[model samples]
Target: MRTTPLLVAAPLAVALALLPVMLVASGAQQVGLWSPWTAAPALATGVALAAVLLPRLDLPRLPWPSALLLLALCAGLGTWAALTHGEHLVVRRDPGAYATYALALARYGGVPLDPGLDVFGLPASDPWVRVGAAANYAVPGTGADGSATLLVSPQFLVGVPALLSGAWLVGGWSGLLVAPAVVAALALAAFAGLAAQLLGARWALLATALLGVSQPVVLVARQTFSEPFSLLYLLTAATLLVLAAASRGQRARLPALVAGLLLGAHLLVRIDAVRELVLLVPLVALLAGRRHPAAGPLAVGTLLTGVPAALATRWWDSPYVASVASSLGPLVAAGAVVTVLSAAALLLGRRVARRWDTTGVPRAAVRAAALLPAVAAATVALVGVGLASRPLWLVDSREPYLPGMEQFVGALQQQQGLPVDGLRTYAEDSVVWLVWWLGPVTVLLALVASVVLAAVGTRAVLSRQPLPRWLLPVVVGLAVTVLSLYRPAITPDHPWADRRYVTVTYPYLVLAATATLAWLVGTGRRGTRPAAAVLAAAMLLPTALATLPLATARTETGQVAAVGAVCAALEDAGPRPAVLAVGFRARVEWAPVVRARCGVPFVGIEEPSAPAGTTLGQVLGDAAATARAGGYAPVVLVGDLTSAQTVADATGVTLPPVVSLRTTEPERLLEERPLETREMTVDAWLAPLP
Candidate 1:
């Protein structure tokens, strides 16, 4: 019994389309149908597109049950993570720059900043949303006082936040964990689908599963980070590239546009993807079976997508410096070198093209296929030479391209100390170190596959019975990917390395691995089961690794028990005016401490700098003004004699004497007094003195 490729393609396509929405839904649902149906425009768009191109529906048939299982797995893994892993209803708004934006949100709207937070208030922390939120807030017009302003742009609300927003809607904001984890899960499933498409069914699932719960992917996605969206973007971009490569004429253009858009959107969120952008161009050209010259125009179009993001990057930290600072001199030079060599190769291909004018497509394609290793090797060697710690010619260009990068490099060097071991030691310990150290096995595997496939896939394309678009890019993209990872930017010896950087490479890496398997097993119906099985196994490892540890009872019993009791009691009590943190340390789960959960805004603090800011003085002034508005000095002033003596002299009312708040520590302070009119009855705050 054999299933047609279209049998898998059409419904898998629908599953790909429904993915984000189902992933976004939290574990709980009151009116589940309306919630998902209302938000999933992507699904509708896919349906509509498929309907419009219904004739193309003639192309492939899908195994409906397998497709259903694949879709379910996304929701399953997501729900598992949401219910079991990561923080819930916790506020950890630390005082960093990200905190500042969270504060600005607090100072202005008080809407929860991240997806994990219930749309109701701050609780869940998501870095993916945080970075974008910062960029959004950076654009100014951040809601004016009172009369309802559209400060947070819904336009930017796609990907993780949009997904998490669904979780927030269903389970409340504290449960936004449900949405992103779901996205992560579905993203893995998509990985499986792509694998099935490019590599065969088993490895497709294998790659998807590996990525879904892989230590770093799960860890970052569980937090308030952008990598989940990055994963999605990479998947979409890689897919489009694959589509464009496999299809001919106008059939490829739409997907190419999609790939370009995803690439552009990716750069906007995390500006570190210029390397991937560089590689996407030629790979797409090679994959499309178009002549190198024809591919040139598409490459330009793809790059043009980044222009909006480049403009934003310039806005972010000053453009003149970002370009150079971002490049890290040697990497830029290497990129330049690759561009020149590749261009020369393309130009030379003209002679080959002319010579083979009647010689036939296969020979021309083999010639083009021949270019893969040269470009790949050039890319790899560039990383090896340029990205190391030793200073080079790039030091001159550092002033413009990357103003802060060299300074960061200097700081890393100074901190690293005399022995080069310091450099190695630091690199090994950082997230960059972890991935690069471990990534080689996978990368090498992918690299070998990419090189072979680039040659093979190119040959096939030239023969005019080409492999799919996605497969070709996977080869070249992986070729470039392995090379890019070797650079110092990801080496941690450089300042640019981070845990999330791998998101840029994930799509191609998986695709290459998938392509390898596809080549090995063949993409015909005969290979589907084994391919699916392989993907399943790869997924379980990471998913278990990511989900199990978090599910285990790790929280201190006292904190958990106390928070649970408090939350239950609070729910029962409903909107009481009780100040949450009374005189401090009220419970083992201290109110202020619990209040400091990640992604929650600083509620009680005031900003001292910039216009319309607030301070302790301003707070008191506002209180005094409130008193004046009521036709008398209504605020009860209370404190120590230093302040009591001063207040006695200034205002007619004498402030009360102060006393030690902690009997153990003389340094600790407190004050109390009675209000004439019960002014702002905040007990922990010094009682107004008479």
Candidate 2:
């Protein structure tokens, strides 16, 4: 009847064992590492590691019926996610960027990706044609030899791409698309394990089912989003940490070490993980002060993995690191301060306690410390009130971060019939945003639960009572959620921006709510138990209503077919190698696909200025001359009929539209919710140089 720690350890162990190998192989540019022949051994090693680590944890037992129900729930959710996965191949957003990164890694095994642009033989003086630096890609610097090698590196850290690369190698595009679903399922199972440990098995099932069906969870799971992987890693890590805290002696050491490693590995997945890691310094130190056997190993393991991964990210993806440096700087500073303070506390805590016991202290201060639990509970309620009431008084806005973002927001506002305020961020309504998807009942329940739990935790700490194993993870999760809700730091758009909640907030709230419900049912008077059950069932309505419509109707449908058509069109243009010069707009969407999928060198044409015809003409003329001299044909690809004609006039060739495919893209909603997609057309003209 007991579920072994294998359910949690297996996934974490495999991910941990494989991550290093994948990172090393990709960094070394070893294409063979992605092959089945080479990957099988690595997978075997992961299984072996899982087996070795499983025995170290003391996981709780669950009823067989409850376990079966949890399994069935995960299975159904996974199937639904895979069946309705989005086709986000076009490089329009983060999902597209992730897909392209995986494709390149799967094909070439590394980055600073060389698209073989040297064949174009273009002079460095040409300003119109850029060989690298497409959307979501960075041109770090020149090659080692000082030649003008246009090697482009993928933006963001390599963790998600490394995971996706394995999927790409297995099933190509399909595997890559479906990978998030598998991760989501694993994440749900991990959540179940954590919940079981914290709230017991029956409540765990309820919590898992509630979270698994939530809109944000479902939306992210159906595409190649990094949130799913983050969720899986974080939940699994928390589960392992719970098991470690429950155990005694050397048996706790391995799980604690692995838990710290997983927490550190989360940095590789998302740089923002620094926030969570920062909060852990004090928690780990407290455990160390308590003489918990796992504490030393956990701290050591965190540094062992985190320091190196952070440095590697800085080295390989400096541009991304630079972009977030504003926020990252403060977090790192806070982490440093916390670490030093925690160390000081661990070293001198008992001495200080002895001195404090002998020294006279103020009774008022003692009374204040005893009342801290009530203060914490009231603070939670106040925060909830402030967030929920923010929109009534505040209108959050900012100058556009990017050049065209203002205009883009304006257009979206107009489409949704909102007042035209391009600068408006709509961040003030974030609490309402949660209410829209989760419903007010669930939100209220979460708030009440948070208040109750915060009070309990403070009481436990102030009274020197033994803390539950779940206390650290829950506290950390609550802290992170509050911070995220305060400053989402994303473009305020529905569904697209909703991804912020998926990482920690939604799951934390769900767990809090379910745990509270379980408490009410178990501890309340007999007459109130039925009321708790009814309240539990009622919470599902709002979440289900919000999720079902979008879940049934897949967004970005036919995009995979559209991409295939474009690739085929390029192939039909010639048997000889060709340099594809993409027009500015098309380059954002197709440049990566052209280089990686079609296996052609891609050049992006800068936007034309005044005298557009002359500008286009000069750029195409130079491109054709350089391409031919290097023994390759030159072709121009544009996104629209007008751009096609512009290229035709520029090259003085009869350019015809070579590819036009229809598809659906997610609708951009301002204040309104997004439940469906709108039709879109992708057009491309390949003007082969005469």
Candidate 3:
């Protein structure tokens, strides 16, 4: 097939050009690759130039080198955004758990949860928690005084690690710093590739550009988190699932295998992709229609290959999922209604009926079989909602220091009886629906436009218009995706279930929506560019507005203290006599570092819970074990005296006298040596009984 010259130029220039991420880390390595890659503004300028030039280039078919370069370009720019933008780039806490845990696992040749080996790093309050969840290796230097042992975390998806591997290949620190962006780039490529394939290159480019700047995605990409990267795997799976349905007479085993694997991998990272697996029925329907029997093999392969990580959730965390809230009803209903209505509209369109029939009996039968996949997908949504309603997955919402929020959570815990599964359903559900001004208005408009498009597409289909067979699925998939979003809210605090995790899917969803809409609108010949640009602009402006403050707060000069966190962790890994942690952020960034590098084990004695991932008692338990096992045996435990006193009162666990150390600095790291060792006890429970 002859390729577009613009496609050829886009990848080549992206690979060769400057990227925005280069402006942040010009080969500077923090804990990993993103810290390096040297965010040179020149690189960003070059990328910007390429971004402009490549699209306009009217080149022709390109070779493998060109394709490889294109992939590299996509990978690079994506990595840039991932690092410079995601996870505070400097270090945000959400996915910090993954990095710290991965580093911990990797440190020991990919050991998952070993008791003998001490986890090295700081800044991580519950490195083990993250290590176990991510199910990877290598404990990151948390830029803190302690580290978490990856007792079992290897379940994390390969997205971040794969990208980091690329950066690592580049050099030590440079690769590590570049890794996040690189991985994010790959993710972007997957996202863009699908977008372009389904929505046309123009829409794909516009969606991707917006994605590059969306604050939440940037935050995820900037750090070594996997959500953004994993989303690619998820999208890839969904795309493949669609393909599997259509390629009946062909050998889809390899592609189906890949899709299943991708789906499984995505589950490993987040455990939520299982919801999409419900579409197995639909997939099977397609396979069965051709007597292909590909469904059984496909199912077996996906389950067998993905089982280790998919089941890793239970292996790593306590039991079932546990979290504070279980209110996905709102998000699910909303997402479901949207999805169903959208799909129903598109499928019912007049155009679809005629063209669908023109495919002849064999093709028609194949298309009819698609109903199974759709039904299966719906089943998946139902199952997810069911699992979520019962509540599995451990979740910790910061409350103590947040004043009113503490009562809020307390009331929730009391009302819900503390869902021990720790499965934070709200994080999955409501966060998306939240009325944050973070996304582009185009997302909303896309939904509206998609309805009209569905109408038009249906008309064209019924009238036997020349829309490709491929398009019919794209429209259906888009509708299904939109419907899938309507699962129960994992986060009641946030609405729409459209939070950070799921927004990555928005590119595909929106693209499909727009594609159907545009197809229906007839892709007007003369003003297509202007119309698309206006639509893109409308959809994207809100995200830019939402991200302004975040970007400002993320500059190198501003995050010096965060830098100190890693330095402090490095200091602890050595033989530092005293390992102290300040706030939650301070502890998260520093403790893990100190634990890993200094080999000095310390506990974060701060607020009871919330944001830090666990109670102070939990950190104490791990520290006590680490210190005792390491033979250092903490001579003095440091923290807020008032909070320390509360621990003493709550659990009856005595505190060794605390003497405030306030010499040069204002905040103090109180000292309390352990008189004896024992199991930790806490007053407030985290969740329900497993």
Candidate 4:
């Protein structure tokens, strides 16, 4: 088969070209200096760099047929993503948080947002006043000297926001909304490139199609989530690694270095990407011992970006880092151990190869290795059985960390008509979660294929032969997938939790399943090839059936219009230099939107039960008094009529809602798959300070 470097290089180029843009934007934001101007120049420089350097790699062109297929897949998926794209503008979940972060970066240029609190002249020492000043994701705190208050920063890293900010600059909100579709298309192309390198072009097309059509892939592609960006980076990195491995001499070093840089860049995209970085250490050492010319460069390239990203995250996104510190600490320790062990093994292996004689090895050991494929297959089956049976015997629950998370879960359970168990994680049903989306057939096939591939990898290791370039990535992907499934540290809600699968599991399984079919087709007798093809075609049925329900059902519909209505109402309310203080229920979902879209200073009032020192009425009275004194109109905002009445009573103002609309929100499922969205009414009441 002819090499098709352009197929992979094209998508990789796009992502690599944006690397510097993300870095520069993030670095600028670190010093509160980020803006569209900063990103534009960085983007131009990155494009120019990619144009010059990528061509110098001298990658071969993709065949026209393969190119056409890739184009078709991207076009189809991109169109679907656009038509069904979500309007997750309300900061209720990760997608909303990401969108708000991008909005802040695009509009305000940086975080630690100044909500003009100094103008309000409220007592910062008042606990209730402080609670009212906080927004979801945008944690509120005082400045260095602890005198002035500011929205401390946004959660998660700057990668998604930095990238999305460029889209916002070019096309405003519309561009930001459709940016994920573009990312999805690029990610699909990258996945195809990696698949084409490992399998043949025909099989790669099948794999790409399978993955592209999967529900989880489609679900995330429609929203502003980090998974799509992470997918693009990881797939591009793997594709480049394969290209590097296939090349010889100094020619191989460039792609390997680029691959390492991409993996390092993944750190910017995801804090947990340190796992991938750690996993690369052993693979690099193994390749080095095999006399691979690219190994050293790969290591050097990773350190180039990885070191800076780590330090930057620690400094700028410290809250997010601290939030995941429990998991991150153990992961880091494990990585250190793996790095040391891998280095020792690499050294010890070289010595053994030079001194020991393979001829003295027992024949039984070889026979046991030969049976590895069977052993692997059985292990996969047993593990699946174990996980599938977990719900039957296990009742999993956990303490909620996020404020009001338990209450939120209880509400969802009440809506779903289940026994209200606020603490129930439903984590034990994680395997069943996979079955809900991938279907039993695809899951089984993927498991078998994964294990079989591992068996083949084991044999190569024992024989001291250089491992397949794709093997390292596959192994790392599998390890991470397993870990994610075991502990998906997200709100245990369907579709929301499904984003966990999008990062690696869904793509990896699609690749594995397609590869398995390809193996069957290639190894079968000439006459049996058609039968194998029929079998392969038959296998897609379960996945197609699984995806049929949500293929066109758009979630979070009408949200954009709802938010726009609120912004418009706020603007028209004759509130020059207005400050919007949202009620507790609205704070998490609308505080950021009010500030970013309405272009007004915003604050969030905590729930009535909050441990804040003052009553809700006192907080409202203070907010009103401060706003009048500062010559700014103070508007109260709430998400529902109940909350609006609560605020109205507290302020002694008859607050009639200014904005009332209903939008579709993704449904929360307990033990079943989410098939449709539920209607959610969004109400916002704006009243003058009394």
Candidate 5:
């Protein structure tokens, strides 16, 4: 009655592959068309299923040609992402800064200001204060004599700018758009390789496939953001650290050093990654020291790489320092400080271990030391709770873009007559929402895996046993879970996937979930494997369904598109330098985009209000006069009809239409109401001369 593993897995593989086809067919039927492109997902699902199952089932390895074809199919999808929808729609000024940074870095070797660039309504002497502030400065500084001496870069890091600079150098503006895609592709490949090393090929392929389709990957990969680089460096560091632990002799030392370098370098990619260093340094120290005396090398490597980045950040005066101080409570910040100090103490004591000729400290002591940071982090987080305490839920959760603290506290909404509930309810709903978006089945498996792995690591440490192979992953998973759990405000928006807070840990999560599912299915049992395969297939669909739009969307569907159309129109309006007057609502974002896209000098016109004793027309007239005086010819103004009418009424001049673009449609994708619009007809006209 003996049966081969391949024989047992064949029916399950076939069954799992067919499930996606059925889902796709059903989806197509509901839409009433079976287009060729629609079939691609089903085919991809089948191929991915085979890729995961065949080797695990001990089937004959596919020959080189088949392997190459499969590899090409996967790689092709990763590459196409850069071409089709790589640039996610820009909704705020921050995104535009990436282009500015790229251009600045390429030309100036830093983000130093270029006053000659058509930024801040060039040649307008009024300071265009609104425009100035958005550009991170105040125009015409109110210095005692009214000289503009002050400019600011705001609370931002230069990581993304630094990366974009290289792209600008390579292919100029267009290359900047393509840069994120390249970084994303590399990240996917690296993630797959890391997964294979830690969780085996089956898990690796599954995680890689999921990441390729994940909304976060699709959106962030093409946009000028620091997250992609952060993920790449984080994954690389973890991989190197894992290899160092698994190897011996000098082999381990090199990886340990390299691992430290990558981890330290990660700071330059994303400042937020400092949070991970708290856990990573201590974990690497313990794990690498298990079989070999590599802890010293790891510590030294981390210090050597980390110190310069820290010093540079201090010298640059991180824009985020103020924000972090304001947003993060004292206790939370203190806990983070304590965590770093603890890791440093452990590393320094590792040297002391050599002095004492000790194998290691007692197991109880080691476990207690490791637990110190987590305990402190949790206890200190309470201060934040007290500072912003409110009912967990409110009846009228009307705003889609409410602040995180408000969502958690519900105090403001409650004061305004919305019903509210206590903290217990909020905590419960947050947990459920997280599980729902992450996939109920996947979350269940991950939970089981985390608990089991954590217990094993704890027991091994406390009982003085050889370090378990699973300890590194356990530490990583715990860190991610703890970080995610602390964020009280929970939003389950599909495109943004608010639960994607722990994206850095996504690879480890997939490994944990996949390993648990594999064990549950009992690979040796022929009958149960099919059931496990079905369950595994089901978990992936929800995420794909939710994130597919995000993966495919290059630009938002509503206001952003309309605004882009206007910018494109401005671009087509010829090479003449014009002082385009934009309405207040549009100016915050439009000014930046128009300046970058249309290469036009822009004037920000205030709405429904003007400086005291100065009429709206006088302001418009002055802006136009200044631009014309500064040599900008055929001065043109672009704004909503109301703002245009305001200029016409105040100046008592006839307005001639240059062009007019439509109002942004209601209910558009990715529109943040506070910063964007769905109302207001935008018009461009020849400015009436003073």
Candidate 6:
């Protein structure tokens, strides 16, 4: 194979590149390998140069040189973004939970909800609600400090935290900073490899570039999000499936089984992947079965991996079940069931048609077999809708946080709205904003590519011959994309703009679009090549232009800056004092960060909503007593202005005036000033209790 060198070099290079991760994963005695600054840009430049120079050098005529370069681009840029532009401290409460999860994984090999380990260098003496979801609630019991240890949420799948833990092992707090971007690069590489095989090298390369610079990718890449890992798994499975479908005998069996393993493993990463799997696994099996007998092995492989993961979900302290029990949960379950049943019906119908063809039964009867499932599906959907029409559990479940159907209908009655407003409104607006991110040209080209792929797929399916090579990706991509639309808003507040919703599948959309263009602009053509090149350049120009801000943007800027300021203020205040966190939101977000970064044990004041809540005086007195008993000279009370007033009204102690700290000053110690900044203030006041 012309690409043999690339195939070999790609894996080897990735392995060599990820040596730091390998060492951490293997429990090497050493600490981190490369400082983010020292290693990231250097690697990025090297890989990028390889992309530009490797093909021109004419070394072994490696296939997919462009794709390799794109991989490098994504990996390099992602790493660079992380090292220079990343936030080391926990910003939002979610990342804090993951940090705790990573800490637990690093220290204990699994989550010990109440590990009592030193987080961010502070011992877990008095546990307060660490904020975010209830899943992170470590203890239902009260502690000696009169505060219960409401820990960080454990809502996420273990995959991301487990990966981040490796970073934790390698570089402590800082190492995990770039974990998301780096993992996103892994996803880009996986996609590039798959695209090179399915769509030519040029298309794969363009796809990689598009994904590398896109706003969504760039945004998610820099954060401690899980979608990148999920994307990596999905792309890997797709790659293996492509290989399995194309190969024969044992060659086919291995990839097929591995593909299934990866597919099943997806469940362990994110519960939502199950919706895609329900449609995808069966589709792959049917497609592969047509060419060869790989479906059985694939199914077996899936069972091998998926069963244990399902069992773990049931047994583990994961919030997946509880969260699912909410409205988003049933919607996903229904979608999965519908997708699987739909696929099964199609397969069963095909079999029935073939069997009846031999017996010479009425063609109508054969068609009815397939149509029966479709009818059943429609009936089920109607029943569901009818049930939903009344005050049903599913409809009722969604009301508290999001706009209910009644509200949606009222909005529609007032003004005609998007059919599924929650999902559609976000998705529609996000796409437009994404175009502004990737440019209108890229978005338009991608849409064209989707149409072209769809047309090609229709032709292949209608024909008697083997399905076109492009049809596989087309089918999978289209199925996944459609299923994505059905995704009931997990985050109603943010809706589709929350890039996590599309990160896994967005790369494929770009790949298909770029590949279609590549196919149109074959090297053999004269004017075609330049014209296609122009189109490709137009598609990428916006992405390139937009990359600077996206890559350099400060994620969770307000929160991180606040935490950094607090850390600075605490460190500057001589000896470490016991911190009293006064607000619910403050304690949830900042308390953990304070303890972790400053090694200060904190006493949290319960929110007014809590049972047996005391007046402001009791809250102040408790905090003072806790600090005094802990043998701390001064008690640092922190909260936003509103909470500060509550503290003032309840306390007799003459606390100092609020101090304003520069967010930039503390952050400079970790990396240079962020390329962009936000206007936010972190105010604090202190009191010394004799």
Count of clashing pairs, candidate 2: 0
Candidate 4 local lDDT, 109-210, one digit each (tens): 777676655555654454544322222444556653466565546778998888987888888777988899888898998888778778877887877877
Q: Choose the strongest candidate by lDDT.
A: 4
- lDDT per residue, candidate 3, 303-383, as tens digits? 754565534334333222323112222333454555465445544543454565686445665576545444544554454
Q: List TM-score per model, in order.
A: 0.55, 0.93, 0.55, 0.92, 0.69, 0.71
The 0-to-1 C-alpha lDDT of every candidate, in the order given, reads 0.41, 0.75, 0.42, 0.76, 0.51, 0.54
Q: Rank the candidates by TM-score, best first.
A: 2, 4, 6, 5, 1, 3
Ranking by lDDT: 4, 2, 6, 5, 3, 1
TM-score winner, 3 or 5:
5
lDDT of 6 by residue, 1-690 (tens): 335446323432432233223222222211222233433454465456335433432112235556457557766866765764445344332455656555545554443233221211222442332333222444343333444544443556665665676677678656776777676777777777777776666677777777777655765666666677677767766766666666666666766675676667666667666666666655654554364556666777677666666665553444445545554465556757765775786678578658866987776755764455345435434432442233222222233323343454345334433343332223223343445556676656666566555555554543345655455555667566544533434432221144644555576667756776777776567688888888888888877776664455554444455555666666655465656666765565455455544556554555544554456566456555655555553454655666767666767565564445434211110101123444444456655543
Lowest-scoring 10 consecutive residues by lDDT in candidate 4? Answer: 129-138
Best candidate (score: TM-score): 2
In model 4, residue pairs whose N, Cα or C atoms come closer than 3 Å (at least 3 residues apart or on different chains), thus clashing, are: none
Angstrom error of the Cα, residue 519, model 4: value is 1.0
Task: Report the CA-based lDDT of candidate 3 relative to the real structure.
Answer: 0.42
The whole-model C-alpha lDDT of candidate 5 against the native structure comes to 0.51
